[model samples]
Target: MKVGLLFDARNPDGWRRPWARHYARILELCEESDLRGADGVWFTEHHLFADGYLPQPLTLAAAAAARTRRVRVGTAILQPALRLPAQLAEEAALVDLISGGRLELGLGAGYRLPEYALFGADLNRRFRQTEANIREVRRLWSDGGITPGPIQDPVPLWGGFYGPRGARLAGQLGIGLLHISRPMFEHYRQGLAEGGHAPQTARVGDLLPIILADDPEAAWPRVAPYLAHQMNSYRQAAVEGTDVPPPPLIRSDELRNRDPDGPWGMLDILTPEDAAKRIIEITQGLPVTQLIFWASVAGMPDDLVVRNIELVSEALPPLLQAAHPAHPAHGREREAGPPLAAEGGGRG
Candidate 1:
């Protein structure tokens, strides 16, 4: 029942020149707002998307670790197959030390043909490569003697999956699972049980787009366009043979049997209340340990973003408490300490 925030670092306006300052402000706000209220902060990695800016999560997370003392830091997902596993292990350990052992590593095989093409990585072998990368990274962290071992013994490694194969792999590897939605959660649970790893206590977190408003109706116009844009982007990725499937939230009949064109043809009509209700219902059915909300998608105004966080904070507590009455509060004794120095250097 822990709550966290996820940001994609998207640049919907196609502007990159101001990315440094924009991201700095983003980190600052997250430190001041999200870190104080939530248990963790998460980011994602994407490339060449005129709509998004971040291509590196380790660097960004290292900054976050330095700025915040209490909140855990993580990557909602980094494409493990595209980079050297050893390098990732080193970076993850450094970030963990900087955060005083509050790093949640979520690794993924990666989708997006454009990213694969840009990196010259074979998309088809991504799953195998991800598995290999996870094995190597774990080895490096647990046994390989990198100077200054991780602050926490066996830093938690969460497998990011959008499908059954990756979910099964996570259970088999004895790592936590990161699910994107409710259906994904159900799929992962079945996958884990089938993998002969039933009753595993490994961590699981859900990623959902969340926005809260005084009146759900008044909030729709402000958030819907951005939601549509993201949906369309995923649809494009799916059409290009990336493993991402069309979002199940959108009904099949609405697309009129035609391929889901970006969000324009499919997403504009859905209301925020409907979206929130859908997500709530989905999470309730699944065995989710934590729920992470992507509150700031492209084109979502900063004011609305803050309001959404407030709404979610007020609304979700009851559900979370009911599901996990023993969930820990944010300002625990372990989390109270002076800010630590940024490991590997750079402003947090």
Candidate 2:
């Protein structure tokens, strides 16, 4: 599986940086990820967020493409239902062109009702609208609706939808899936057959919301606050404008072992060895093409974040694909010990 980085460009209050400076850092990190052997650089989208969450992922995507020589630059998800099909197609094509055919266009039916309202889009019809937009985008790229078309004949398209229903739609539409859980993977394959598409047409990836450190227990204190900010922000936005009670804001220490199956899922911290094992379990016996980890958590500082990227890009991949080495009673591999998930940060 390709090692990828996910950047949301979220700068929470109390940890904020100037917007231009923050963006520049992202491009620099994208360059670093590429030079350091990372395979893809992915960004996420959000709108009207208090932390100034990235609203235009494509803009950064183009910049990242230009900066990196080899990494594929893409969106973990761009909300298609909120944009005019033609305009979105044009922008995505430009990004692809800048990347020299290295764009993975992931589209999702976003859950943020406020984002829909901001664009005068109907939230209830988001899935159908997104499906139509996907068709329109394909036609635009292939049928000459777009000028000076994208470098790739059909830019690798993916559905960044959540849950079984969204997975099925991705299958019927015959696109790749960016799912987070094992159950969703099953649903996506099922949808592929239901839509008369070959199951082999399936390409899947997971947004593994994890942190890798040499010593996870030691890193928890430094990592928890930023992680908490990231999760709590998502939690609040999810229930915005709804009668449903918002989940309680997560605390830093509590994140050490919260419910993985709970609403605000666990933010796991793992050693490279343990992380590889967790990823294997997450994607084992599945067609997982990519595995992505967040580049930073709510604008986490580079000192703490960059090392993880280096480990993910370099140290981790080898362990994942290699045969198990015989370990001494006390060894680097032994440092990983039992799975971190047993503490509630992984698949339950």
Please, what is the whole-model Cα lDDT of each candidate in the order they appear?
Answer: 0.67, 0.81
The superposed Cα distance between candidate 1 and the true structure at residue 237, in angstroms, equals 4.0
Candidate with maximal lDDT:
2
Clashing residue pairs in candidate 1 are 11-51, 232-262, 232-263
Model 2: lDDT to the true structure: 0.81
Q: Kindly provide the TM-score of model 2 when superposed on the true structure, using C-alpha atoms.
A: 0.90
- For model 2, give the 10-residue run with minimal summed lDDT: 339-348
Measured against the true structure, the TM-scores of the candidates, in listed sequence, are 0.78, 0.90
